[model samples]
Target chain A: MQVVVPFAAETPKTRLRSVLSAAERSRFARAMLADVLEALARTGHDLTVVATSPLSSDDDLVGVPSTVRVEVDDRPLTDAVDARLPRRGRTGEPVAVVMADLALATPESLEGLFGPDADVVIAPGRGGGTNALVVRHPDFRADYHGASYLDHRAAANGVGASLETIDSFRLGTDIDEPADLVEVLIHGTGRSPECLRALGFELERTDGRVDTERSLDSTSADSRSR
Target chain B: MQVVVPFAAETPKTRLRSVLSAAERSRFARAMLADVLEALARTGHDLTVVATSPLSSDDDLVGVPSTVRVEVDDRPLTDAVDARLPRRGRTGEPVAVVMADLALATPESLEGLFGPDADVVIAPGRGGGTNALVVRHPDFRADYHGASYLDHRAAANGVGASLETIDSFRLGTDIDEPADLVEVLIHGTGRSPECLRALGFELERTDGRVDTERSLDSTSADSRSR
Candidate 1:
């Protein structure tokens, strides 16, 4: 099977601007992408990354030992995925698309995902985005606007393809809101956490919330300690 | 309005056992209840706590300064809610059941929730549980089991009562999982975070996720520092 991981390095993680600077967002986005790559690398699938920009280094970018491909597509996700992914009838092997920020994704979950009997499998996000999906129907095109899972189900039905939705905590979470950082810190099993620590974000209990606490000096001190 | 807040204090927060000891759970539960009480205190509504066990201290449990009442009811959530909530025909004022752990809840959110025109208003949890609800129709009784939001909707339709679902993050979140602590810590403006900190819980970034970190020595140090 072929797997596609998309990265929009151009204007990455705009929602995180409240917590992360532009440079920090880019670095963190890449770190999350690397983690996803590492998990996918263990799955033994033919892997490809559809990128909005070029990668800076292979050191953090884990890939399958012998096979991995990188392609640049600046279009929106739906257009990029539809244009890049192989149609179902063209190949016997299925095509899977995984969101780059799934830091908690594991090989076992991917196994269950790929093992489904349905023609289309959707790993739904908390807010209706399709976090990861395996498309088996040739005519099915991904629609990733608001509540895209429902739209994808309709698209699959248009082709008479059986659809299955996986309710997974790891797959359901995709970092978007400032509040979402807490989930990644607690549930992500990837380099994302390591990057956050490096960025000097520390957890502190405040008046009524568990808050990320950091100072400019703390960032420098943490980096120096590392 | 007669507002009921249910507390299963006898077997409170069983889901939090993985992260907290029994004594710690009780303390945290009381702290959360206090915060909820604090918020509800601002609404100028008649409030009652239907408790599974008698509360030893009502001083810290902020209620309407002059009119908050506590009633002990050992029944399960659905039964206790049905019995305690004011029936529509008996009372001209609307009735609401607010979760005890809504540390992030504010007077404004409650105002918006109570201000809705629906006969039934459901504040849903991350899981299938119902966090808080407002009942305007005499026929509406809260069913808070698995996927209770859907069940409540059906009940509303059965009674021909208009139903609306409130989508506030503060209203939707009820601390249930170890990972859920992050929400309470990041968004909660309650005594729960203070209690958690006193228990030596702190935030730390690790390999793949952000975690609530605690140490035996830190607990001692924190207590001393206080």
Candidate 2:
């Protein structure tokens, strides 16, 4: 099985710009990618990282213990992933595509997406995106866009492929917004949480929903002591 | 296409005993079944209501306009439903099994399950149950207990069936507990809400989560006026 992780390297985490600076967002995106890579590494499958921009060996892929083959495909998500999808009705091997921003993903959840008996296994994201999927049928292709989970289902139907949808909370939480940072703080077991805390983010409950608030106490503690 | 609705008519909605008496629960169950039958009637599929006990035409099938074939199966859910599943590789027609307590289900949501082009179309419940499913493949069978949605996914894999899971909030909410009554009041457009309202249930919000509270005002207003 070949696993592909599609990353938006050049302009990643644009939704987090309200809370994270340009450099911080870049670093945060890499932290999330590292967490995803760590989980996929435990599965012992061939890993590939498809980045929109070229990644640095000394920076982006640093600290990832697995041997990840990085491919530079600056194209949009749908085209880049579709190009990597084995041409319909040709290959016998199954290919998996996992998003780079699933900060809460674990080996257990990835196993659900990989070990299913169908021709296509889909783990749908909370926001109607296809966070992770394994394509086993040779006729199936990837289509990533608005409500891509539904599109993928229809695509599987189009190719007459057997499909299974895995309902997993961890694989569903993609870190894309300032509010989404709180999930990493609450459920994350990787470098993504440490990276967010270093940037001064903390969990706060507002109107009965868990949200993130930057702690001013970190900077103001010294001034108050004086 | 054959749409089979498995109903527990003999001992139904036992979980809602805290808020409803035995007689009220039976009436409420019948009301929900009527709503579901109405929705299925609009889809133009052959409807079958498989009840654990025989249904009374004067009471259970009273106001439902659709021609529903009723079957009395005293066995458990898995056995009763599996008995109806077509033998593997023997038939090409699809069989749909929908739970009778999906109080929030609509004709539009049912269209999502019926129109999809897959071997199996599953609508999962919030509590890890399979609320509705359309099995297009002959090898597939029903398994409904202890996270039956997951079991169904594995069953599809076991028999090599293609599957799709639809994400619809209306189709997901099965009215089993007192708390689930709120969804019927909030989103139900059928006889279920009218029956609930007649029983004095009203929507209430607490800590930003919607809940249900029986209205004492209707009875107390008459006493207060005197």
Candidate 3:
């Protein structure tokens, strides 16, 4: 099975600047890519990252292992996935769509959504959003925008696809605020270019206040969101 | 109050080959120095790192702030602190002896040990050793050698000095073994030259399957002896 992570390289449309600084945004995108790649490597999945913005380049994806394929689609995140589905399906492999902002996503969470029996797998975010979606077949299509969890479920139901919901905090805590940076600094597992960047922000603000208890709180919050 | 961190530039007694590979040891040392300087800056401390080995140069302590003083003692860790205490006491300043090997030691832990009324403050290592010691006056001589915690307490009793002990995991977990590297990676706290040198050992031997929980369990076990 191949995991496809569709990442929008542009800034988010929301007015949540208080939560996500420029450094945080860049870190979030980079961290998601690193985590997904590491997770896929750990789980023996052929990983493909589809960048939805023209700004994302091969150079920007440094530290990513050379084995992973990178594809650029200058269209909306959902449409890019839709266009690539048929080509990926030719290989007869399952596909997974992961967002580029989840700082806490782990391999265990990805593996849970990637079981062979499931036709569709959805990992929901804290704010009723879907951070990860997997389709076992090429015919699967979902409108992955605006309350994407419900949209994914509706799409799965319409196509008569067997749907599975996975609850995972590591796959749910997307960095969108200063507090989110704190959470990541305190409790995140593994390291990435993005996670390191986020850590710089965290250190600048918190000045090393991250303790075992704070780390536990961050991990628990991430797990609860899932 | 000024914080004095005494470091031995040449650790001839410590075996580097067993603990860290050559590449890892150098990297670990550089990273540790960087982190210490950064942490001191963040905490607004009057930081002075006294190098007890004659090999150290003024340029080696770069990145440490101008306000922070750097001195070369060319003596043992204990003897260096004993020699420097009189000059500090002449200025009516209390001196705190912080060992550089405690990877998780932070400025907050330092502040917690600083008590105006206490004549001696000691941070006991998990291995029943002293990682940090603070003395209000230089005249109160105490031998800091093997199993120093008991020796320090006994010396404090002899001098009629008020002794204070602060049990902190951050202060307790010193980097000594390959297993301890996992805890540093998981906790995201504490960095040592020795620990940094062990990073490659962690990367190669563990292949990223570092059992942080197990490492912490070991830490707790070590702490019981203190």
Candidate 4:
């Protein structure tokens, strides 16, 4: 089975702006790519990272391992992944379409999803969303990660493939905000070794100007309100 | 206030059998020490690491930052920490005595234990044991880290020191057995960065292969049995 991680290298979209800072967005993109590659290596699966950003002279994706191929496109995210799937000879093999942003994806969950006899598998995110999808056949048609669980279910039903859903906390957590980083730090994302290494990625400021205690209390209160 | 952490450079007499495997012992010791230091650093507290082994070596304490002074003693764990406290000039300030084995200790919880007023603070561990102790004065002593939360409370009563117990998951998890490593891997220790990086630190092979699913099932069965 081949793993296909579809990611928008640069999220110029306004919706993402509210969720991620400039540094966080870039780190999120890189971390996702790194995590996908690391997961593949751990699971001993063939993997490809597909991005929708045009290749730049100093692109961060330049020195990735030889086994892991990168495909750059000036198209939408889904289109880029859809185009690359055929070129990689994914017709007969099971292909897992994973989002780069989920920091908590683990090898056990990936292996469970790829188990034999499962024709289609979907991992649902916390907010009734989907973070991962796996299909045994290449012909399965679905817009990746848009109403993902519903779309994939519909696609699986249309194809008459047996569908399975793996509910996992590891697969549910996708880092998108500063608060999300706090959660990741508290409860680790299994694949976030590099992201965790980045210095100054802490909830409390060193100089104590932020009044971190009050800030945390307010954030908790806000979350409860929501 | 100064933070004092007590660690045994050599395994205690009771722990000798468990520490027979040199590699395992090395990894375990390093993990425990590293976690304590990292938690102290994260909490923004000045710390001194006191090793209770008579045969302590510089090699055993390598990679620890220069700011962290190491004190070697032939006495018991509690006494070693007590001896180090006075020399650091923390007589007037409150001092927190932390166990080197509790990887979940966080900065917030540590600081919260001393909020507004200095008191004798106790954090109990999962196995009905104490893992953390904060004292306003060095003279305020209680038998530390035993099956004696109430004993420590009684001792505090004898001294007329204000006693406060801070309940936190981060302060409760102390690595004592093979099963504890699984908790460290899943939930992560506050100081996991260095411990996880040490040589021969394989999460899968630790303690004769930790089957988390089996353990969970057994726990459920035990609960039903109870």
lDDT of 3 by residue, B108-158 (tens): 655666644688888775334676777885556646665566678888888
Q: Chain A of candidate 3 scores what in TM-score?
A: 0.75
Q: Each candidate's TM vs. the true structure?
A: 0.52, 0.52, 0.42, 0.42
- Candidate 4 lDDT by residue in tens digits, B1-226: 6788777766522232232245445555666677668667777678787776532556565546567877666677656666654323544777777888776556665665556364578876543456788777445665554444555677678867788766454566566654455445544544453443342233342212231222223211221100
Across B45-163, the per-residue lDDT of candidate 1 in tens digits comes to 88898888877666445432446688898888899999865575686567899998777677876776788888888876553456788888887777776557657888899989998
Model 2 misses residue A48 by how many Å? 0.4
Candidate 3 deviant stretches above 4 angstroms: A1-226, B54-59, B86-89, B189-226
DockQ of each: 0.03, 0.03, 0.01, 0.02
**Docking category of candidate 2:** incorrect
Name model 2 segments beyond 4 Å from true: A88-90, A217-226, B1-226
Mark the regions of model 4 whose C-alpha exceeds 4 Å error after superposition.
A12-20, A54-59, A62-64, A84-91, A189-199, A203-226, B1-226
**lDDT per prediction?**
0.72, 0.78, 0.58, 0.56
The Cα error of candidate 4 at residue B161, in Å, is 31
Candidate 2 local lDDT, A1-226, one digit each (tens): 9999999988888877777667778888999999999999999999999998889756787656649888899887878887777665666678899999999888877887898889999887643567899888877878675557767899999999998876565776677666567668766878999988887777654322245778665432211100
For residues B94-160, what per-residue lDDT tens digits would candidate 2 score against the true structure?
8889999998777878998898988888887654567899888777878775557667899998988
- In what order do the candidates fall by DockQ, top score first? 2, 1, 4, 3
Angstrom error of the Cα, residue B2, model 2: value is 34
Clashes of each: 11, 4, 9, 0
TM-score winner between candidates 1 and 3? 1
**Candidate 3 local lDDT, residue A85:** 59
